[model samples]
Target chain A: MCNERQEQDPGKFRDQIRQGKWQKSTSGACPGYVQANLVILPREFALDFTIFCLRNPQPCPIIEILDPGNPIVQEAAPDADIRTDIPKYCIFKDSKLVEERTEITNLWRDDLVTYLIGCSYTFEEALVRGGVPVKNYLQQKDPGVYISSVMCRSAGVFWGPMVVTMRPIPGHLVARTVQITSRFPKAHGAPVHIGNGEPIGITHLEKVDFGEPPVIDRGDVPVFWGCGVTPQLAAMKSKVPFMITHKPCHMFITDIKIEEMAIS
Target chain B: MCNERQEQDPGKFRDQIRQGKWQKSTSGACPGYVQANLVILPREFALDFTIFCLRNPQPCPIIEILDPGNPIVQEAAPDADIRTDIPKYCIFKDSKLVEERTEITNLWRDDLVTYLIGCSYTFEEALVRGGVPVKNYLQQKDPGVYISSVMCRSAGVFWGPMVVTMRPIPGHLVARTVQITSRFPKAHGAPVHIGNGEPIGITHLEKVDFGEPPVIDRGDVPVFWGCGVTPQLAAMKSKVPFMITHKPCHMFITDIKIEEMAIS
Candidate 1:
């Protein structure tokens, strides 16, 4: 089911996931296609959350926002059923994770509003293409994720510190990495902090709020970017009554190519 | 009350407008600061309208979306009142222009949501600075605005053809113009159509749906950009129950500088 031919097409790959035949991380599948971080919230919290993303665009660049109660994505993927397309999903009640599901067909509601946010994985592809070595991509492991001290602009009920992903880029290739990633603003776009993470509130390089620990080379510089997981952290801090999100690294693949999202 | 001293400071300039001492266009004022298009809607339509802007960011880039019923903008300008900050405003009822007013304080409602959309005026500043001739800026006339045949991605109750502002640029400067404007994504960055307008449904270049007739010169190319007036046109087409917008050429100025909005 995970043959090279099937993995090259987003539609076919999505089919395998929808049928519960594939459940691995979506990192290398559908190589050139876009992957999105999912956030499903009730209509009541939709407005504030949308404004929060708009205000803090770097960390939460919105890719596609579905109309309330509509699970069929229109723009990113014309007919993709968001409720069952992703390989995995986490259900949160009052900011606490209560369950994990392969599909949310039964949990879906008419009032749920889904947001497909730009994920760093999209830009990481560009980084790799630009000759910047992405250790996590090479190792096939999740990037180191952390909670930065940077407080995002609060929009109504949504307010919390920003969450970021850290990558160790070779010192000489740092400039090239920034240039390449800056092209995809819809993706996390350029690094938020380049050299030092301490100023942004990352105290210990070894500590990570999420994902695996970093594999840093001796001459590598720490590069930090706004993460899509920010909204989840904010929702948790706000203690949202109920929300659904994709499991980390198990992003929902979209029909859009990386080039379609690049600014230049 | 309009003086060089007051014009330089957005706060002072807003005060003069709030006091009804200034009643002219906002073009060329606050030279480097950002200016915004205003859109006020009821909470019933807030979610859908926001989604519409998110989907069509090139035309309706959102700079600031005030909290429902909260007239004071927080990020754009800390204490500026959305109700009275702009020089002029138009009140719309059932999609028809009901009244032109100096302020909407009398009509403020708790259920009302105010959206500060990015204005092309902000990018025009970059063009002029980059040596690109902005005829409208030099002649003190509004740019040619027209309704294109291209329809926007619909979001719930809002859907309409994209409205564009046409500018005549010398053929040689076309590439540079695109580069300069592309920097300010928040300000409807880059041209949607360049060279010929006929392809985008402009049958006659002189026939504009709104604003002043264009001043086209020989060896000039017609460049079209996504205009911020798009949302107002959509609101009217949808015949929303109530809405408020700044009068054409009048805009809400923010403290953010043009460089702050530039992507690179």
Candidate 2:
């Protein structure tokens, strides 16, 4: 899957996905461009969820928000359409995954508001550029994700524990990794925990909850970052009647470059 | 008033103001602690205003937001009360300044939600420490403020132009000043415009719109930062029926250290 077609232009890549010619995970789809987590909710619940993102920015850094009933992503990618850009979409009804579809034109609602959230891929690129070897990138696999006991600050009807993604780094590069990733606050920023994940309620590194189990070398330490999947977990836990999110590992590519989101 | 009393503990400093012994502006009070701009709005408009802050983070960096009908500032300072902690309060009716009082205890309502926004004093401190001499600091006066033509992203019913505060810095240290201030994104972050104010519609730096007029030295260049007063300007311009804000320069001091809010 890591072929020449993956490195093509972001808009052209979205075009392939939109045309249903490509429907796989977007892990290595478009390098250098930003990939975001998508969450669409009815206007009645949009305000509380927007506040939820503001309250817990680490897990859910917003890239851009579209006006109600608008399918065009104006800020992140003006030419992209949210309804069919992503390779796959998850439709949740009464907190249960009811169906998965290639396009959500049938489920689109006039009262729905879309939120584009920053993903860990942005910071992962920074870590790699900073000479920190990420185990997931090295193996060309998704990092392990776990639902931690750390509860996010509840906002309105949204209440749930935080979900985090884990990446093991060589012990010598832990500090440097923190410094490099800190520059992109919009993309999960710094590590929430380092050295051990016990305090966050992850007792077993081998027994994972989501994605593949991480490969930790002898001197490598497991690092955790607030995952973009957190808001989905929260929405599901709160029993939101209607919600839409990008399928796991399938993201919405944006025109924003990784450097543009960095603070320093 | 750079007296010993100014360096006292934040909680104790609030005690002085709460007891009526301190009634002056909170410029130098609790030096190392974070000072914030205050905005109290009814719960009906709370969600929109929160979204407004998230959208226009530069002009309105929210440090903490209290739950509706709650006066206790749990995150920034748990022991303080929003209704009477500040030295002064301005009451607005139909977006017009209707009354000024030392405390709003009598006008307190359960539906009000308080928002504590970041102030420029944090970044200014960093600038002073980084060898950048701010003219307003040397002259013991507040920086000049102006209503700029830069329009803020409107949220719901909130709509207005951005308000900016100007500090004259030595031409050689303009870049250094930006670097120092950029670390504190929560505190107005970096300069919006560097040299000429006319581009931002500020034709007269001498005839200031708010605060004291700045003193630009021979080799100094005027730098502008998004002012905390911006949200207030928006609220007033939108003609919000009811609002409560701290009197100009009378800020809410929090226990969080300035370094905690720095990005890198």
DockQ of each candidate relative to the true complex: 0.87, 0.46
Fnat per candidate: 0.86, 0.24
Q: Residue by residue across A168-254, what tens digits does model 1's lDDT show?
A: 999999999989998998898889999889899997877999999999999999999999999889988888999999998889999
Model 2, residue B99: distance off in Å is 1.2
lDDT by residue (A1-264, candidate 2, tens digit) is 357656468898899999998899887667787889999998878767876887888999888888778898877888699999999999999999999999998889999989999999888877887898887875778999999999998877888888999998888899999999889888998988997889999999988899899988899999999999999998998788999999998999999898888887
Docking quality tier of candidate 2? acceptable
Lowest summed lDDT across 10 adjacent residues in model 2 chain B is found at B1-10
Worst-scoring 10-residue span by lDDT in model 1 chain B = B1-10
How far is A252's C-alpha from truth in model 2 (Å)?
1.5
| Per-model tally of clashing residue pairs | 0, 0
Q: Candidate 2's residue-wise lDDT over B92-138, tens digit each?
A: 99999999888998788988888999999888777887898876765
RMSD of each: 1.7, 1.9
